[model samples]
Target: MLAETARPTAAPPTPPRLGFLRGWDTAIIAAVLVSILVASLTVEGFASPRNTGFLLIDMIPILLLALPMTLIILTGEIDLSVASIAGFISCLFGALWSSGLPLETIIPLCLLLGAVSGAVNGFLVSVVGLPSLAVTIGTLALYRGLAFVVLGDQAVTSFPRAITTALQAKIGATGIPVWIIPVLLLALVFGVVLHFTGFGRSLFAIGYSEDAARFAGITVARTKFWLFVASGAIAALVGIWWTLRYGSARGDNATGLELSVIAAVLLGGVSIFGGKGNLPGVIAGVALLAILRNALQLASVPEDTLSMLTGGLLIAAVVAPNAIVWGRTLRRKPHTT
Candidate 1:
């Protein structure tokens, strides 16, 4: 008789647990709450809707830039050319508009220029296999130089008042600007894309191990190339929005804006080395910076102090993750009994 063997029933699968808060996210949430409270209490006029609306308006561009910045950083890559791309697009927009190109054609053409600029950065990084840092840095200079060549120390400040009126239009009695709508919508889209989609999971995989991800058939190169392209496109749009919002477009517009976006992303707890973080955390990060900046401005604090805070935040973002990893390693090491 064949030995009647009873196969053991497979153990029941563990149910998936839903988790939203992780790592520094909880801390950032608390900090944001505390900041709002403190700012309202200590800074006169801080709680006023008009000021709040203005603060939100100023933050809109950074908020937009931070979305893709979060994604790029998630893939263990950086795109430092974003600010330069914005500046370049602004220059291109001014040059085209001044040359009497219709607003419609000028906008699309500027966006195309942004895409082409991003493609160049992606080509060098992905196809040529250059380090992302090196590639973006080089393109950073190249794009900024192109911006200078395009505008040549000129500024365009005569955009239609209607554009600004529409963009800066107050959202009813709330006193909040309409620009926040796009920021929120984009945030929702990014949050869903990163958290719920296969493509988003592939980004994490690439970040953790590109070779293994490639073996799993994730298109790392294509994915990264598109990321840079998206970043450039959004940044270009920011340039246009900024131009209209302030009624000015210059080659040097949004200069050094990249630092704020980078700091916010890092402060949001996205791993600088990659493969971690969420949109909520990033939003908190952006809010934190905006609150501090608005409060300090209200309190007559010098800009230098604000710069110091930014520097400190950037440093913390870099150090915190490695510190946690080191602690984990220590815990995992078996003690000699």
Candidate 2:
């Protein structure tokens, strides 16, 4: 007898899930809104378009540097020398300008110097198998010292008018600085590269587990080496832009900004341990910090106080996720015996 087969029951469908805007992104959004509100309330001209233009101008350098720094950190490595490298490039541009090097040559030279510096860092970390922290920290002083040696307390004020004006000008009378365009452009490119490319996946994998990435047939060293180079090149580009905008290039420009760049990268949800983060978060983090600083400045806060506040914010951003995870584990009741 042909027995009627029982109809198989279908598995229950998974519940609809909230998408990628997780805790970190949420925090970034909240921070942005709060900073704007606070600025509006606390300072008379804080919300004015002119003040915003200045803020945007100031943010461009940091934002641009943070892009590749985000990627490098996502691969579980750090580039502490970005600021120093930028300083060096700024001085290089200035020195060359004074020496009558054509602007074209000066531009490429700045980028080339950055690439060489980054390549050295990459070799140290990838080939020599040194710790990134140690290597970059050493390069930090080395690069900055090189800057001082090149410029030696001097400033360069003469640059091509075209370059300087492009950096300093407002965009279409909107009070949005022209420099903001490049930051936004770079952010878009970073987002695309990280989210839509095989190389990006490889980077994230390496950050998560270096051995695993190697076993999976990824060229760990080469990828990481290139990341540093990219960081250096990008930093140089930002440096040129910054020097142009400011109309002066000195060896000491952007000193102590390594902390802010790293802070912004970390605040964007890229873990110190690596294997987590994205371009969007990094961009938001940059914006949040810029807005916060601008707001605080408008309130006439002391520079030391602002530094303290930024440090605290960095610490909290790094700590909050761990605390939340711990709390979740603690509150989760044991299954019934």
Candidate 3:
């Protein structure tokens, strides 16, 4: 009698929902596909495997630098000197090669220099307590100037064909360089670290607010220091790679590259306010950029026009979310009496 007195009903199940592409990642991916289709249809030889190899080759440096840049931005910081660091590494590489040092020896040395350069920035921003933007801007000029001092307008093109050939070689019929695989590998590592670990969660917390992260015992300064060092080291590595891939080393190599990296990172849906980003989105954003630039170049678009387009994309990235929020506010009506 007691058990039959009352029968309890179970709660209804929650509705199935779509979470993929809940942000700009899907848009970027779609844009990439569309650009590829258009380029293939209109630009003669645009869809050729060789052209794709060149495209992926050109993207390696930018894509490599963008990885560390994503982490730095996630912590609400910036590194404007990435390109400069790369240039400096390239210049130093040429100088060292001219001095008869082995390429193998030069590679590790240049990487060391990169780490040190980044450590300097980290010290200034994390320990000295300077604003990241200002510090990086100052170092940008400093590193670039050092590169000029090292190379003095000279270009070194005496690299061995073996290395260059290896770098330039195609991977099977995929038209992707041997180096392009590294980008995917790094992205996978970064994605895992940022999405599936406490360290990555800490980055978000720091980006949300350093003060809060500190309260949570997250070691904000130490994390930032490492991030900058990683950025600098990766940048330096990119510089070296760029030199080898192009068969030339110059102080001004990769000039203005930082802008493109920053633009792509922001465009990937990593909010300017920090604590809002994902590696998949960043990859999509970078791919979109590469695709657009490649397509436009095939169509003989002016360099200025490309710059304008990049600028427009960046502006939209910054504005679109805010505009959406504003619209939602406006559309909401007050409760009636």
Candidate 4:
């Protein structure tokens, strides 16, 4: 009998890693749930529908701004001017309304102004090759100063009753704002685009290595430019909603909101260094922050204390991820004999 040639044994298939369970997003979601349970159990009336509605309403602006901010950071770029853009557009909205412009006309004009402001940042960063951080920081100051120039310290509070009411309207007895429907729909669009599109993939590629991305035919500068434009537009929309929701438009509208937006984005697991994150974790991050604030407020926490807490969370969010990665890296190193 001919000696049978021994077939080479195939390597066993590697077991799939339980990465989702290990993901930062999963941790954030778990934190949100745990926080909710703790808050509801400890804080009287925290589980009430009225408070739930109010909490969600408060979450809207941050959620809106955080959406586009997510995409921008994914490309390893940051826009520090987003809150300033919102404030400027809000002030402009009031000025335009006071000048007797139709609401319909003023709304579109504000959006256009937002787009222009974004284009300025985009041009500086993308075309002139300035760092995004420095460019947006300069525009942040510029836009905020322009806001005060446009509206001074005066607030415009004479918005149409019907419009404001509609904005603050709730769906049946759920105590959730009617506006959340549209916001959620918008979130759906962003989620689909970010996770399911070629453009989204390109953003990740650019974030990883701009040179590599450009070599692969991605229009890096143009993409960055338009991302800023979109960021501005959405921020403008947030300004509009904020003005109507609170029934006030001031030059200081959304003042210091960038802190919350950035904090939420990072806490949701988007790397400050960029190229990784998902919308769901971001939504959870927003919810977590909002709930914690609401719970603390209900517990009579001072505003100053809340600010400090936010700062701490921001620092922790940035540090924790890097530490975890470092730990993992050390673990994966080969042992010396």
Candidate lDDT (C-alpha), each: 0.83, 0.81, 0.83, 0.86
Candidate 4 ranges with C-alpha deviation above 4 Å: 1-21
Model 1 residue runs over 4 Å out of place are 1-19
Worst 10 residues of 3 by lDDT: 1-10
lDDT of 4 by residue, 1-337 (tens): 0112232233212212222255788999999999999999999989988998999999999999999988898788989999999999998998889899999899999999999999998898899988888889899999999999998999999999999989878889988888888889999899888877788777877776676677878899999999999999988888888888888889899998999998999998887776667788788888899999999999999999999988988998889988998899999999999
Worst 10 residues of 1 by lDDT: 1-10
Give me candidate 4's TM-score against the actual structure: 0.93
Q: Which residue runs of candidate 3 sit more than 4 Å off their true CA positions?
A: 1-20, 332-337
Using lDDT as the measure, which candidate wins? 4
How much does each candidate deviate from the true structure in C-alpha RMSD? Answer: 8.1, 9.0, 9.4, 9.0
- Residue-wise C-alpha lDDT for candidate 1, range 1-337, written one tens digit per residue: 0112232233212211223365677788899999999999999999998998889998898899999988888888898999999999998898889989999899998888888888887788778888888888888898889989998898988788898789888888788998788779989999888878888777776666676677878889999999989998998998888888888888888888888899999888887766667778888899898899899999999989988888888898778866987899999999997
Q: Compared with the true structure, what per-residue lDDT tens digits does model 2 show for residues 234-331?
A: 88887787788878999988887888888887888777776667777777888898898888888888999989978987897789866876789988
lDDT of model 2 at residue 178?
70
Clashes of 4: 0
Root mean square deviation (Cα) for candidate 1: 8.1
Better of 3 and 4 by TM-score: 4
State which candidate has the highest TM-score: 4
